[model samples]
Target: MTDITRKQFIKLTGAAGLALAGGVGAPALADTFLHKMVRKPIPSSGELLPVVGFGTSRVFDVGRSAEERAPLLDTLKILYDAGGSLIDTAPMYGPAEAVVGDLVARLNSRNKSFIATKVLQNGKQAGIDQMNASFHKLKTSHVDLMQVHNLVDWQTQLGTLREMKQDKKIRYLGITHYTDNGTRELVEIMKQEQLDFVQCQYAMNARLAEEELLPLARERGIAILCNRPFGRGALFNKVKGRELPVWAADLGIHSWAQYFLKYLLGHPAVTAVIPGTGRPDHARDNVMAGMSPLPDEAARKMMLDHLHGL
Candidate 1:
């Protein structure tokens, strides 16, 4: 399939009244189209973040060899070109942090990217040391956001994070957990500390966060970064052979990825949904969900019903 430029995409979809040919293989759309993409503000600082961002977990843990790094370069370019910037990574993810740093440096997109990494050490000094290492690996002195991964020694780590934020080593500080089991503890932490962000699992299959974590984040003015948005590819498996509902096209959803992402974006409290992908085509498909006309309450319910039936 031939990749389409932003102008070609707009002309094809707008003037020619055509849909995306295959939902992938297209490069990022143009800058003029970026303004039309959905953006939600960080409650504490009112800085707007694109509703769709990148994630580096299992997919980004690869060797520094060109064979391993080539596709990743394309993926990051597709993401940045499409107006997506926020990237979530952690020291626990092995070489993922180094890969992101190297790739971003190669692309010279450090100024354009919103880099987020985490610290999971047990002691305050250890936490500080881990974050310092993150800065070095990320090839930047100042990071956009730093999170306490899974609340590991959260109290000790948060103190370090707070100090870093004050010193301008990191712009924001928050906590993260990938399971519904951690929501209660996250809520308690939110009530006690002033946080700029909270990342938790919130997807079609995982609705537990919606019951409490999401509402309280809004109440406390904390930005939400949703992880496991695709249930680690379980949602795709569930609909492997099925076709999209006829009404999905009305919202400009061309693929199942957009279908799932749009459902999460439908909730008002969701700030951004980070779906990890190493494939550039998948990256292109993922960013398209950040556009406007996302699913509404009624549409979301319909989607839920459809998924349940599937």
Candidate 2:
């Protein structure tokens, strides 16, 4: 195929299949676009969820000050309208739960979204209280998935999360660790116990997650939630002047963002990749990455080589 121009690139999206648009009175299915990676089955339950996810880490978690969160409302709407369902947030992110709570309530999209959050507390009672706060803040009856954030007080909190899952207040229970050190321990925790989802940073630039965490998740049938898909803007900067490889068309990757996102979502264990953003265009581009052909082995290797060279 010939090289796709920047303008044409902007118009043609990836072919991996994604549910990019939604219509009222008819909720979109997981397989709406056929451009994103195929939906993965939840380990504990059979419900299939899209492998692309949304995060509330940076500017998005700020609803405390009116000026700080004015744009996030629009961003969330874009996400919902585009068939995005998985929303990952935590008390670790300042005011994110609060912002999400208000917006979800106002939008009345609480049931439409799959809520995933964390417990950042010590001991069983404290963990329960924090979860209650999360529910109250998010204005939801229960969370879709609850995780122990970075193993903080894991011993004390994990048991409580397990109990909540038993009671059905939460659908899934899991643990998270961001660093490589955390990976081994998280893997051990998965080995010892049953978990539904795990959240961590992953990108073409950060292959550390691939080294062991992802493999373990795949082994346990645990869903992996990937954060920092853009490498916190570093990857974007690296590709600023670079053009998409001509062969990208074979995999349906049209832009640098889509190239990077598709590469991560292509991984087998990745249940979802949560890239943070507050802009409508960025949200659309990121969500659009969810739709189409995740490159096969050969294309992925070439993508890494080209990105490294760029």
Best by lDDT: 1
- Root-mean-square deviation per candidate: 6.0, 6.3
Q: Which residue runs of candidate 1 sit more than 4 Å off their true CA positions? A: 1-36
Name model 2 segments beyond 4 Å from true: 1-38, 64-70
User: Candidate 2 at 233: error in angstroms?
Assistant: 2.1
TM-score, structure 2 vs. true: 0.85
Per-residue lDDT of candidate 2, residues 2-58 (tens digit)? 444323433453322222232112234333333443566776577888766678876
lDDT for 310 in candidate 2 is 70
